[model samples]
Target: MANTSFLQLSPRAQRLLKTTQDFVEQECIPAEAIYFAQMAPIGSTDRWLVVPPIIEQLKAKAKELGLWNLFLPKIYPEGPGLTNLEYALLCEVLGRSFIAPEATNTAAPDTGNMEVLAKYGNQKQKDKWLKPLMEGKIRSAFCMTEPAVASSDATNIRTAISREGDSYVITGRKWWISGAGDPRCKIYLVMGKHHGSKEEPHRQQSVVLVPADTPGITVVRPLPVFGYDDAPHGHCEILFENVRVPAENMILGEGRGFEIIQGRLGPGRIHHCMRAIGMASRALDYHLNRATDPARKTFGKLLHQHGSAAHELALSRIELEQARLMVLKAADTIDLHGPKKAMVEIAMAKVVVPTMALKVMDRAIQAHGAAGVSNDIPLAYMYASMRTLRIADGPDEVHIRQIAQTELKRAAQVKDQLKHKEERERSLRSRL
Candidate 1:
């Protein structure tokens, strides 16, 4: 779907991709304006309490159209059986419209949480949490990041999870907890350090399923990204004041937190990158539309007719195509090999895709002049969302470091080649 041959996709996935593209263009994009209008104004108490009715209407439509939970990979029996690469093709279409992701129930935190439960959760856990999640009956949050530490290295989280009798008590403060502010967000997949474990730092951590209604849990406020609240599914700052859950909620037993998260984040990161490509494509659309408008002229020439504007727009297109190839390669690699083996590709996509999207959106914004930065067009909001991807999951520096380390593995071999070159040069110099 990333401009690849149709032969690369199964017939079924191809059909789904076509269906999803049409659905987004016809239904999802049209409904976005209404969805925004239906929302309770920002800063209103009802912003969190009341969801847009249009979203439910769209969700019902999406379900009827067979577009629901398409994020679930083929490995899960409960899913429509799309592979990661296949879902990625469709995901870009969904990313074009903000409402599309939620309408189809493929939004973040939930997607990652559902993957975790499906892969690691016990029968009881699956039935209780994963079922409702899969059915779109509830939303969820992943509470791993902490305000007190550099959460990029997940092992640094200071949240305390201690076993006490029949339950485990969790105590810590977490920020940027996406989806925490949603009223429908009923469960939390919380990651914390197990108390008094002498195990290695990575092993001492674990994730537990916490019900949102559990005692001592407080949602302080939603944090904004570049001043956008992203209400209803806000990234929130929450305080867990001795919140407790059953010991049964511990996912895949103790000391396996890193393992579980590593699995969850790899695919999730790819999903985000794919969505970013979609956003970048949409921004380019806005850019072209504004630039080619005959009424909008600079020095008696249309904006696109100007060499500078044409060059910038052309460069944006080239950048998008180049970056998309990398992301598609990463997705295909994930399909062929597991995410663990595709870490280099995934890291490369994670680093490059967001950066690409930002540049593309900036060009689109410049084309629109002042209107682009305002809420007048979606470009500003789109820019903010893409910008966050640089830091979320893993920051650009972290992924760059991973890529560099992989390259550095060849340093010794390069050193030997350098020695050979030196000897060859000496012999040539002596002959001369």
Candidate 2:
């Protein structure tokens, strides 16, 4: 049976729910061998070349079923008319398999980048970029982090973007640039220092749209997670030296990069957390099944029936539930308040979900003995991905700081309100 917690879709969301569920079971599951083969430690160029056509075919089938573009806000015409709350459920469904998001054209970097353009880009800029992006004709990358700086503190980014005439020249080295290695990747939402005084650090940075084919842009290397380099769509290190683009490429004007991030990262962060939940859930299932298997058991008792293994499995379930509820609460906050207003909840979830997922993965890995960390199971890979997230997006400490400030301010506001009510009661009693 499929997972019941896959998503709770409304009547209108039923189509997307059914479509993605069917696609994962049929196409994505069947492609696991091909997927793993292509991702094998010793890579083959043929395996890499062969998988694209297979992915394209699966994507075409999904598009034909009207499952395309369900990841974006329904406020935009490109996606199914669903709110963030609605899409969070669907993202969980796609999270079941690593390949499912791409099959539906709802993968990361692109999803976040598309939202950035849709929310901030001008008509000409949207026409040149957003349209193709929404159509899934090409993929894109977000170039915000740098190799030399503590990218978690984005204010410290040193990538240089200087203005000259009608153009802006960019120069920097960025690592962990996800989706940049794909053959289909055609654009990059590059964030860097624009022509500005260094005194205003935040204002000094700007976001510009740079074509993947722009001159002087170099793919330095693809970084491996643990030991696997996710080919065709791996995280990459890119070098931009004297790369120039039309000044028209700047999105929502300069110094507003921070403003754009305000709108961009909220959804992206939650989406990653939701998917992490699904991945952990699946890993738990694998561990449970492996433990109980008659052939796999060492003693007469099934692995799941054993004291140590069962304890970890039980803890995994509890942790998974806790993380899910927290993510849902964060999603609700985003729905109730705007993303900016719900910043504390968003940051808390970004910190909490990944930590929970990492723990769940660790337990599952131990259950599998040494094989858990082996490429034979997805546990190792999922763990690596989740671990990076602790430092990626924003670090745990940064989010904790924001959450602390929010709680302090909220407590102070409540205290003041109560004091005012007491004062008003005292005045009324004296008048009486």
Candidate 3:
């Protein structure tokens, strides 16, 4: 078992985490039905971009309980000042219900965006955007993936941000941009190449803050995941044609998009993994509930009485526990040594948690038979969301490659040290 002694959170974080657990159970979980009803398409208009009323109610309650913005770390003096390890525990609680994260103001794209602004944004930029985002008054989008290039290699981004006088013109087509479908989405963090710049591949990219209503900017459509267009926070495809923004909107200066990417994505990936553990735990609960029902029997035995079914439940519990421990460890590392030093651990958690969650959800769905595939349970949707994580942030293969490289480098260093030690002993032996 992984040691959890290092995860002793502060009293403030512990109190907030308990409050968050209660809020998610009492408020967010019960509001799922209302959220689903409001998300359904009505008449000729697509209501997918509308935020449900229940969400606002929950958000208000969350603010009153002081459970808002828990994802922000102590580095940002203006935030709740929770460490990454502490926030990870709170995030797992929020992940139990789909509505909880947004209610607590810890939803992605926004969390990542807030971190970027807090770390890199100038005072004016912070005043204009970060303040509203932190307040949960408005949402934002991250536009980096391009339709034309393999976005996994972020350096392949072809969007152009060219300088002209006091402004920069941005032209690109970005897809899979989460949170763009929200009507409250007011700003975008767009990544593009600095036109005519001769900087290295990694240094050539820059991220700029572009207002959603900027001239020539258009939201083309929302992309569906396994036929579910995640309403009000849909993943969208957008176009920017000669969209102009003041040069001052550039984050951390020109040719520094990769730097921001590294800083923003490290924490974002771990947050997703922590949430995955929560989702898996819920799925396991659903599975156990169904499996233990005496009314439902298979082969003249209750589901839980069957040896295979019981084993499956036991395996899921073990997997979920292991995944949770790995995520906590990763969060602790990021908290202690900074994100750069924690990359290997983050990559490991990112690869492990989603895959484990998906498997647990798959077994849970199987336990429910046909109802699992239907909207009667949240398993199908949860499965789809968890499945996406394997490709999001960075794909499993990418993380695997990174982990392998790190391990191989360490092995090489050990081998060199052993060789030097052996040679030194031989020299001493010859003298004897």
The candidate that achieves the highest TM-score relative to the unseen native structure:
1
Which sections of candidate 3 miss by over 4 Å?
A: 1-6, 42-44, 417-432
What number of backbone clashes does candidate 1 have, counting pairs of residues 3 or more apart or in separate chains? 0
Candidate 1 CA-lDDT value: 0.91
Ranking by lDDT: 1, 3, 2
Between prediction 2 and prediction 3, which has the larger TM-score?
3
Report the lDDT of model 3 for residue 213.
91
TM-score of 2: 0.91
On a 0 to 100 scale, what is the lDDT of residue 78 in model 1? 79
Comparing 1 and 3 by TM-score, which wins? 1
Q: Return whichever of 1 and 3 wins on lDDT.
A: 1
**lDDT at 112 for candidate 2?**
90
lDDT of 3: 0.91
Task: Put down candidate 1 lDDT per residue, 1-432, tens digits, no spaces.
Answer: 246583378888878888898999999998888888988998898988889998888899899989999988877887888878788889988999998999999999899999999999999999999999988889999999999999999989899999999999999999999999999999999999977799988899999999999999999989999999998889999999999899999999988999999999998999898899999999999998999998888889999898999999999999998888887888888879888999999999999899999999999999999999999789999999889999999899999999999999999999999999999999999999
What TM-score fits each model? 0.96, 0.91, 0.95
Residue 375 lDDT, candidate 2, scale 0-100: 76
